[model samples]
Target: MSRAQEHPAPDPAELGLTSDCGSCFGLCCVALPFAASSDFAVDKEAGRPCRNLQDDFRCGIHADLRQRGFSGCTVFDCFGAGQKVSQVTFGGQDWRRAPGTAREMFEAFPVMRQLHELLWYLAEALALPDARPVHAGLRGALDATERLTRGTAQELAALDMPAHRGEVNALLLRTSELVRAEVPGKKKDRRGADLFGARLKGAALRGANLRGACLIAADLQGADLRSADLIGADLRDADLRGADLTGSIFLTQSQLNAAKGDAATRLPAALSRPAHW
Candidate 1:
């Protein structure tokens, strides 16, 4: 039996890594900046609320985000950072009501997002039975990252993000190696390859190390992507119809959202099928 079968998959909701927009204070709408591109219809600066952000902190164009030329908003996932900052970091304070806290809250949102992203990856790593050798270290990193997320706004602002991310990245890389090692025979090492718009339909990419690969608009229709390490890979507009990603590691909802997939595409258990597919 494969190492992944050694243990049952953990509940992704238990990790608190999924976005809950209702609990958020529209932090992503205000904290993040977007330029006028194919993704965004208008340019929005940081710390400024999007025009579509309603008074109740919900997106006015949520249902029609893609049709309204705000497809960028549809693909963006804060990994539950919005609710964490709104409810925990600021203690349920709404930036609209507590205008004084707006600046700091905006600053803390992105920082918390990064930390929470690390927590998400670390949690997934712990679920991998093949990565059992580093499970203890992964737990420590997860705990540390969660603690960082709970820090004060000032603490988050003063954080050295590069250093912290680097430390966590090292552990994640080790976990990836341990888990991906289970794949027999030769494995593809296409880490960071720029395959933008490459026509690779029906590719035999099982157990491929595609970390950080630029696969923007690549034709991956019906590809076998099981057991691949897709952490940080740019999958924007990549066709994934009928592709199998059953055991892919480090693939996030944001990546899936950015890609093109149909019902026939097999995703990991934790991820959902993107509505845009």
Candidate 2:
């Protein structure tokens, strides 16, 4: 697995991991950098707003981002970082209006994003009945991360979130082990497999250790993925129309955004299917 895939994006609702662009200052459009790849049409430097960003902090072509060569935008989520930076850190100040604070705002956005993502995972870990043994530690981490997320701009920009994540990640690993113990099979060690575009319809993958597997564009229709270790697995464009993903670990909305699913797709409680699905 690539180093970038080691961390992924977040119970969105109760955990505040869901994106709320309406209340945001278009931080994602400005704070993130993207090159002209298959995912993006144009090269945009960090702290520079995308040309598609509207004056109202909305995307001018929100409905047709992919059609406009901005597929990356569709799959991106700020994990509530944009709104937090806009409302809490800057007190509703926007970069365009207050150019003085733009640099700090841009710098702190990604840091806040990481903290928020950790909070989302910690919240999920605490919710796992099988992971109750670590609930106290998870709750402590959640509270600490929450406090960090509410820090001042300088504090956030200087935050060492990776240190905090390492601590939280250890707890999550314990949580995963406890939950996977109930999968009722000898766990498969398929970690880092390059299963790209492989046909695996109706496969018995329950409790499989598929961590960091490159299942990109693979046909997984009607597959039984219950209790699979999907942490860092790339599900981009993978067909999961009727696949059962209940109890899958570390699956993210970004991964779901890049895939196709339907009513027959059973998901864990923390995840919801994309509307386009």
Candidate 3:
């Protein structure tokens, strides 16, 4: 089977609260640049491996990252971006083996990282029952994003990422506005509501609590889900083309498999699409 076929892409549904890191190659520890802060306690440059990264590409302090002053590592989620770049885009070759490919690989890493971030948000947008009015648009956006993720290295390299990001940002802003506009009072609980197949075009859902909600087949085009809590939500076949999910919480693999997200849809850490798709 082709690589893509070998990795059954995850659906953004059936999120039973589990993190899936099977698709990753520990790229975040090596490919990303970090500065010492509350999140991370050291300084590292892009393309340089983290001091805590083990030979097998796992974290040497995996069990005690936070205590070891790598708290940021614990919170940082690549949304499967590392795996896609390491295994799919580079055809399973690492920077060490293909030393010449390092520059390109490093360059592509951040681009894919941003796209995966968007997928996470789109997944969360589809789970909100209140944003049921724009489901169709959301699905369309999801498909578009998926295609972008599968583009060739040259395509990704040449991409005007800022322009593309701007387009997605517009949609996420709208999603946030729509979702939060309806609450009569500031203190409303819309957690775990069933919003399968709802239309939520251009909705804004920032900082919303949607834990354990059912959002299968929902439309979430151009939705904003920044900082939303989406633990254990179902998102099977939901649309999320132009959604933004940056800083969203607790998203998992089971949720992604149930939903229909594309390259443009941002995703959280720990999950990735099947390379074949």
Best by TM-score: 1
Candidate 1, residues 1-277: lDDT per residue as tens digits?
A: 8545664444557667788999999999999999999899999999999999999998998889899999999889898999989999999989888899999999999999899888888888888878888877777888788788889999999999999999999989998888778988788999999999998899989899999999999999999999999999999999999999999999999999999999999999988898779
Q: Each prediction's Cα RMSD?
A: 2.7, 6.4, 13.3
| Sort order, TM-score high to low | 1, 2, 3
Q: Which regions of candidate 2 deviate over 4 angstroms?
A: 1-15
What are the per-residue Cα lDDT tens digits for candidate 3 across 168-244? 65665566556656544453245779887888766777667676678777887778776566765676556767677
Provide the global lDDT of candidate 3 against the true structure: 0.67
The best-first sequence of candidates by lDDT reads 1, 2, 3
The numbered model that scores best in lDDT is 1
Model 3 bad stretches (over 4 Å)? 1-10, 13-22, 185-277
**Comparing 1 and 2 on lDDT, the stronger one:** 1
